[model samples]
Target: MKDRIALIGLGQMGLPIATRLATAFDVVAFDISAERRELASRHAGIEATDDLIKLDSEAVIVVSLPNPAISRSVLQQLAPHLHEGATVIETSTVLPDDVREWQRMLEPSGVRVIDAAVLSGVAQMEQGKATLLVGGEDAVLADVQPVLEAIGGAGVERFGALGAGMAAKVVNNGVAHAVMVVLVEAFAMARAEGVALTDIAKMLDREDGGLQRPLNHRIMQRMAAGDFDGGMPLEAARKDSTLALAMAQRSGTPLFATQAAQTVYDIASGTGLGRKDYSAIAQLWEGWTDRGLAYGA
Candidate 1:
């Protein structure tokens, strides 16, 4: 017989993941919504239930809850009944601290917890193209690798011991969400300036220009090496930012991310980093947090 796996949360992403896992393991699915439970029950390899107690016998449990609070609440309710040596794979997009707390809460009961952040959407899950950013003991992760592969056929990136996966997920999301806002702001300004959106898209799509170069080439290399010297200086970049702001003001365009970025440039320049590379703006973060973010620091 196939190994039994208990799956919690059958929402948008969770439901797809459950169905995918059912292709390999005998999946016991649970959800608070009756409709969702019914939907999961219709799948051939899944056994859907409302009772949390029904999951007690399963050695592997996967959680994909909406938020940390709900995840904690559900885990708290199920903790006492979990069999010894059970491993819980938490795929919720929560903070590293939150998963660490869960690990602490479940450790006394011989329940192992691993944070496996789902890095893709429902469509990716359904297509088996999703990736999992995992953090846990190597042995425990190896034990559950097949289940992870069943859900995330794209790949699994193991970040490190517990909480690292959530950290990676949060950082990845921060960049993606911030870039989205930046794009929106840029598009709004482009529309105001009568520039074709397609033109802007084409410019940004270039392999040697736009987002890729700055992130993958000069700036990132300089920042990573802590060698912020002899490049387009911060002062020059600040001047360019000033020009952009002036143009935006003249065009009656309000900028959010760009305006905020200008503030960082201004502050970094004022602090005598104007002579360094434009990437020196990163130093402000190190100073603010008293942490070395540069590689090998």
Candidate 2:
């Protein structure tokens, strides 16, 4: 007989993840929505239910609720019914503390909790191309490796203990979402300056240009090495930003992200980092928090 997997939540991401898991295991899918339960029942190798009790016998349970509150509520209801030695893989985008709380709540009953944060969308999950940022005991992960591989293909990375997966997911989303807003702000400035959108896009897409230069080339390398000596100095970068702001003002373009970024360069310049590499702006955070970002710091 095939291994049984209980999946709670059949929303956009959850539905695709459930279908993917069904390819390798007999999935008992649950949802509060009658429509979703019906939809899941139609899929092969899936048994849909509205009851949490039906999930009790499954050795592996995956929770993919919308938010922390709903995830907490559903897990609370299901916790009492979970049999000993059952492992719960939580794929919700929640805080690291939330994952720790769930682990605390479930440990008394011998129920293991693993934060398996999905790093991609529904389309990726359906295609088994989603990356799973996982955190849990090594032995626990080893036991459920097959189920995770079934859903994420080969894109599973275990960060550390229980809450680390959620931490990685949070950091990844923070960078991605912030960059998206910065891109919009950049495009607005470019459009205002009469620059062709396609040309701006191509320029940013270049490996030796804007985007890759900071991430894959000079800036990250400089930051990682803590070697903010004599590259394009912070003073020069500040001057360039000043010129961009001036151009935006002339074209009546409101710059939010760029303007905010300029404040960082201004602060760094004022702190006598003007002669250091422009990436020294990153040092502001470390200085403020009394933390270190460099490899040996």
Model 1 lDDT tens row, 138-170:
998988889888888899999999999999999
Estimate the Cα RMSD of every predicted model relative to the unseen true structure.
1.4, 1.6
- Candidate 2, superposed: residue stretches over 4 Å from native: none
What C-alpha lDDT values do all the predictions have?
Answer: 0.90, 0.89
RMSD of 1: 1.4
In order of listing, the candidates' clash counts read 0, 0
Residue 238 displacement in candidate 1 (angstroms): 1.0
For candidate 2, the 10 contiguous residues with the lowest summed lDDT are 215-224
How big is the positional error of residue 31 in model 1, measured in Å on the Cα after superposition?
A: 1.1
lDDT of 1: 0.90
